[model samples]
Target chain A: MKAPRRGLAALAPFLWLGVFFAFPFLLVAKLSLSDTALAMPPYAPQIDWSKGLAGLAAFVRALDFETYARLVSDRLYISAYLSSLRFAAIGTGILLIVGYPIAYGMARCPPAARRALVMAVILPFWTSFLIRIYAWIAILKPEGLLNAALRALGLPALDILDTDVAVYVGLVYAYLPFMVLPLYAVLERQDHSLLEAAADLGCGPTEAFWRVTFPLSLPGVGAGALLCFIPMVGEFVIPDLLGGSKTLMLGKTIWTEFFANRDWPAASAVAIVLLATLVIPIVLYQRQQARILEAGR
Target chain B: MKRGPSFFNLASVVLGLAFLYLPIVLPVIYSFNASRLVTVWGGFSTRWYAALFQDEQMLDAVGVTLRVGFVSATLATLLGTFAAVALTRSGRFPGRTLFSGMIYAPLVMPEVILGLSLLLLFVAFGLPRGVWTVTVAHATMTLCYAAVVVQARLVGFDRTLEEAALDLGRTPLQAFLEVTLPNIAPAVAAAWMLAFTLSLDDLVIASFTSGPGSTTLPMRIYSQVRLGVSPEINAVSTLLIGLVATGVIAAYLVQQRRRATA
Candidate 1:
């Protein structure tokens, strides 16, 4: 009796997730097999089981290695993908460089001061994301605050808006909190005795950090990197708003295909490809998280 | 380990904090600027806040957003708490691993992909996309967050209290109410708050599912920002920031007080 009741309870969420979330993913995969012409209102395609196999065959036939081939040769998609990767990579790098020290300082502070400092870091996040991005427009635009200050200082006015630099800046600014919070959490829990032990052995402050503290903080670094990198890879608003019309990235491409072209199949194809690319990093991060949790236990 | 105060650390912290706050601070400052040109700082005034209060579209969007958030957060929290209880306390079932993975997929999946897939599903079902659809979509996504928080709380809990109550001849339901509920109430509250915040913040999924008449506050803000910066947006953002900050602080203080008492 207990077993049955427990089984039913355990099964409840899975059933809900299967019906809602998993089912939609399967639907997308299934729809990807159907012909684009079959994508009309009451959007369910009439599936003949035999014809479904044929439709799958047709979908494979349409695979047009040309898309992937073009993806390689076509400078636009290739460059955009590269640029996005570059932006995410560099942005994550900068966040680490910038966020680590701050998180360390925060960790070293007294508990009350740490909480207040962390709250200050998080205060900006309370505002709408779009509004914060919009605020960046006022600061980064050609005639905006940054440029105005530059002009006043007798420096050349920089047109930072709609540039790759702006994209990097925007991404890093947006995601720094993700980096800081995780790093802070890890560092706060760190055993200060380890550092003292290293110091008693005549190790310098820098050497002590590298030898003892840094190695221990690797998990936090990994966690923070994953948090920053994964979302930045698929970021839409920053690229669209700050990168302007000139910058073409996967997120904007997928958005246009779904909304403007109304090609669900092609859009699904793009999403699948993006997901496939992201899966490796996500899997690695999950494994790391599991290890961390295991260690905590 | 008594290192002198490092200037490098101090300077970096100051710079990093400035970077985080600049955008927020600029908007707040601009909201009071009398000039329409966001780049120029004219004399300060409360005109933008006055204008924001008068904007019918902004008011309507806020109303719709609050309604959707309220419904979705409550539903997601309930479903999430149910799932958390089941998974943490119950026996294993077939496809238990698969079910766990599916529940978490929404949390990590790109919102764009989730939005696209849901939009297609709605179309496939011949369901009209609107406020109700948005609520369902938001609940689906926010449930994962609620589940994760509740699961974290459940991990530290001692289950023997409930078992002891059961052994004392109370029914399972009665034991749960009398023993388990009180212990995990904090987690439930945290889960609800998390779900509420997530539902309030969601834009992409809501964009896909909401109709013309059901535009959410974030959607409205996105459209406004797309054109250019506006003082009214600044006023609205400041208000939202104030509200969320207050809530977070209150929650933190309550948690601290509980910890002290415990």
Candidate 2:
């Protein structure tokens, strides 16, 4: 009952996050409601601090949903939002297909090799992500290494860079470890006896895997998918670097609106909508993670 | 019924690794190219490295990045350790749900949203967007990661050691400093490094939060990369890759050795 010191300890983090983390969203929301203006901060509805309360009332009255209205009316915003979702879905699927076998192989490795294999998967992740994505630019560019190698082998040059195909390739390459690590965690801990039981009962390797191993790895698959999909939806670097100017992803859309157009209100509106779209899945993922932690405890 | 890996599994592992590593290896290899053209390798040389070191703007950006990384990582570690301890130790305070939500939300929040929101907040407060602002933003973003790493270690921690120290006539702070600190040192170190790298590698958030004269190395590299690939950028990228790879492998090996000893 008398733990004031502990209470203070708790208050420090709470205060920091409340101010820095949670409060900013309110600012974004407020900015989204305001109109664009040619000003220092590039948003309208400025309060006249000379007449404090009256000024505040006028500012509140100035607020409207005009930016959100524009977002709905604009075809570009709608397509960007849809395109972001489509890219995320396709990227997640590709990552799952490409990552599952590698994770399975890593999980099934001899105990001595498993740690090293996990490190191999994680090593690229720890390296600079921007550099890795930039690396793809080097490989996929016209007349780059891929084409150079193709020409050496007497094959026609592949023009994959600056295309949607290139974007998917970059996503898969950059986020493969994210997809694999969780899958490996679940698969590595699975009991081998179930597979053996299936084998003894006349299940083939593929059948045993599909029924016993794959079913149990569903949690990991979900985890990995959400991990990759959530970020891919708002990913700017991958698309901007590889997807060319024609790709209309929401993240890039927001950047152009904010930086190039200096329309902070519009950018904030797009960001708010993006958050609204992602809120449910984010909460679900958090709950799942909490459950996993509880189960571990 | 023990069996070696099937051909499907083995082949996938090889191909997957090749896919993951070739992009990175190619850049590092080409960094030493003597030709000005990235595609054509005239011969092997360290001329790009020499050019990279002499570039003042690149050096300035590097200095800014290192300073930002160190400051933000330290701040995040300190605050995040407090957050982690608060989450794990302090049972059921008011606003606990909200506090915990803030911690986890950043991990899932898009960088663009985070960056934009913070920029607006700084603007509202009339704070100049510069190195310190970027540092604050990075700390805010990275604290969640730091808290998670520390919280994982804390969850598995045996509290009895600290309790014993407390029972032996030490104050709570003293017990924490002497017993808990040593026990969680590795996790704290790991968290700091994670935050540092997250700050270092960030481009999107820093782009929004940064101002003129505070361009980070990633932003600098990005501008050049957007224009086109250059040998100097390759040299810088290779250096970053080497530095990070060495640090991570060393940390991982230390962790493995600690696990073995324990």
Candidate 3:
């Protein structure tokens, strides 16, 4: 009775996941296999024995290294990929630089003020995301607040809109919270005695932080970097809003292919490649998490 | 321990907060600016807010977004709570690693990939793109967040109370209902609110799955901003900012009161 009841409970979540999550991916996999034109109503599941394999053959033909070759050869795709990497890397770096002090302060704050400090960090998130990005437009445009302020201060008005810099600023602004939260989570849980010990060993304040605090915060840093970097790589809204029409990112390319070109197969092909690229880091993170869990046990 | 106040730390914190707040504050301030151009403040007025109230498309989008958020948040919370309870209560199981991975996958998957894949899935399955599709996608993503928060609460939960209730002749269901439910109610409530906010703020998946009539508030805002940032968007954003602040403050106060009592 106990075993069956346990088994039933365990099976419930998997069933839910299989139906909702796994089924969608499987459908995508199937769609990627069959010819797009033939995938309509009265859907054919039959396969020719002479064709050797069903989905496999379809997948092989669709896998046409052509798309991959195109992605590599095209200057647009190559440049976009490189720019996306640069944006993600630069954004992550900026977030770490900006977030570290805030996280450190919050972690060290008095109990009464800690929650309030954290609240401030999370306060911007309350507004709709698109609205927040829109706010940047009000600030970053040529005639926007930023340039107006610069002109008022007797400085040359810097035209930031539609620039890579604007995209980076927006990406960092949006993702800073993700970086801070994880860093704060790890930092707040740290023992202060370790820092004190370092200080007592004749280490200066900065030295203490470098030697003791930074190493201990690596997990949070890694988690934060991963969180910010992963999504920022494929970020659509920021680049779309701030980068203007001329900027080409993989996300914009994918969107145009699906909505503009109506090339569903090619779009799926791009998506599959993007998905495969993301899966590598994710698998590594999962393995790391598993190892951590194992060590804890 | 005897170190003086660190002005460097203070300066950095101040700068970080300024960077985060300036854009948010500028829009709120400009919502009242009488000028058509966002760069200049001719005079302070509530005219844009008045205009926002009159926009039919904006109002319709808000209604659609609210409906989607409500249904998705409630359903996701329920499902997440069930999964959390099952995972926590059942000591060990086969494929546990796989189960955990499935739950976390949505949290990490890029919205672009998830959105495109779901779009393909909908097309393949012959499901019409609409509010229902958007809700399903939002719930799938937000459920993972709800699970993580509730699971955090469960990991620290004392299970002996449930065991005692069972020993006192309560059925397993009664024990769970009477004992476990009361204990974790706060986390469940928090999970629901978080899920709701997430569903409300979502744009990418909503953009992918929503049809003509199902455009959400964020989708509408994106469309408007894609053209140019209008004063009306500032007014709407100001109102949204107020709503979120009020909700967050209320949650904070309630949590504080509960902590005080405890």
Candidate 4:
């Protein structure tokens, strides 16, 4: 195929992405600058495109930093942002704790059992995310299975259903597959000879893991952390369902502003800041990914 | 591939698998519980399953969800296959970096932002939010997922078969249709399933975009769940879990059979 013609074959998808993905980001940006109104379509200083440049200029002139000012002046949004980051970081940390062993174990399984082991890891991933989160609620509620089992074991029945613990459970459960898959991908491809060499040098198994395997797996850790943390920052359902009254995550904040408060401009402004907060880590992730790919080549 | 890490690996696998499957299996088991409360097991009965069938609203949501999943998955697969082919074939083009970033960005972007932003876009265009809007939104999100999976397959594809087909006097389209398509069909099918699952599983995105008459199964479940966890939801969740588990196992069996034959 002719090069340009072949390139044009890509146009359809490019157009789809442009219209659907990039354009929405643009729309969000524009909406963030507008003011919230009590009217339908809900934002003020609506850009009337029919009036041409003058309309655009008028709209620009009408824009104010009032919504952003509200975001800063109110402690709620600020605390929400910080807490979202905290939740995401803690959730990611727990996922690493929970997922690394599983991935490492799967990676190290004997060749005969390896396929079934990996399949077991991935089976949960194919199930409905919402349903999975829902499944956890029944098990974590006040009179739930865990408490029942705890009582049976003659231990204090912990009440963690509406607490941060529950949210953490939800977040880790939801994002564990994301963490494990990347870790598994990296860990599976590792050279066994490196471990053998480390062992040959008189390092014990634990020492070998710490010195050789752990460092080699850092890329997977980073990738998995990035995968889990980025989405967890704006996670809605997990925190909403499991968190009950306690969790004030940024994603919940955005959802509340738009749906409950009917404050479009405020929601957009909050989203803009959340995006700004994420840009640094996201850029760093992209850079690291690129570097890793280059090194692999 | 393994030698002496026996005890450690075995313990980790058992604990991890238990953690992964317990919540899932419990929900399935409790779907048969005759108790009004979720935790207690009064007795085994299929009453919840019966209630699920009779619940008109839940049935409607199921219909809407399946329609959305089917339509969105098909569109996403079609668009995603083309995008994957282009990434593999067209080496580099203008805006290629931005193009790839867009493809990968959505894979990790928060569903909340993606949903809200797209809702705003729909409102800006004065489009009604309903079944089609939800479908479009879902397709947009899942297309990224589809592209990633299909791209991985295409990247490792052997090219000599297509070259041979071309050398045998087949035209480019003919070579692609006859050889390339067949080779990548498995990946494409896999992509479609992924897209379908993503669409079916979506709650945040669908909630933002769906209007009256377009309530999806997850949306219904979310609303019901917000009130309280009902036995009906457990039954529904069980069925969905069963569907997905069966699909995964069948795919594995197919792969294993292929490996054995080869």
Query: Count of backbone clashes for each model?
Result: 0, 0, 0, 0
By DockQ, rank the candidates, best first: 2, 4, 3, 1
Give the TM-scores of the predictions, in the order they appear.
0.90, 0.96, 0.91, 0.96
Clashes in model 2: which pairs? none
> What lDDT tens digits, residue by residue, belong to model 2 across residues B99-125?
778888899788999999899889989
Model 4, A1-297: lDDT tens per residue?
Answer: 656666564688899999999989988988888887879998899888899999999999998888899899999998999999999998898899989988888888777687777777777878888888888888888888888889899999888888899999888887888898889888888999998898888988799999999999988999999988988998899889888676799999999998999999999998988888888777767666546533532
Q: What 10-residue stretch in candidate 4 chain A is worst by lDDT?
A: A288-297
Give a tens-digit lDDT track for model 1, residues B1-262: 4543367766767888988988877777777889988766689889989999899999999999999988998988888887777657664666655656665556667788788778877876879888998998888898887887787777678877877898899987788788887888998888887787777777778888888899999999988987777778888988877777788889989989999999
Model 2 off-target regions past 4 Å? A1-8, B252-262
List per-prediction Cα lDDT, in the order shown. Answer: 0.78, 0.89, 0.79, 0.87
Could you give the CAPRI-style class of model 2?
A: medium
- lDDT for each residue of candidate 4 in B1-262, tens digit (9 for 90 to 100): 2464478777988988888888889888999999977657799999999999999999999999999999999999999988887777766788777777777788878888999999998998899999999999999999988987887777677888988998999987788899999888889999999999999999999999999999999999999998888989989989999888788778778878987997
| lDDT for residue A42 in candidate 4, whole number 0-100 | 85
Tens-place lDDT digits, model 3, residues A213-237: 9999999898898888878878888
- Which whole-number lDDT from 0 to 100 does residue A213 have in model 2? 96
Candidate 4, CAPRI quality class derived from DockQ:
medium
lDDT of 3: 0.79
- C-alpha lDDT of residue A268 in model 1: 71
B79: Cα error in model 2, Å:
1.1
Number of the predicted model whose DockQ against the real structure is largest: 2
For model 4, the local distance difference test gives 0.87
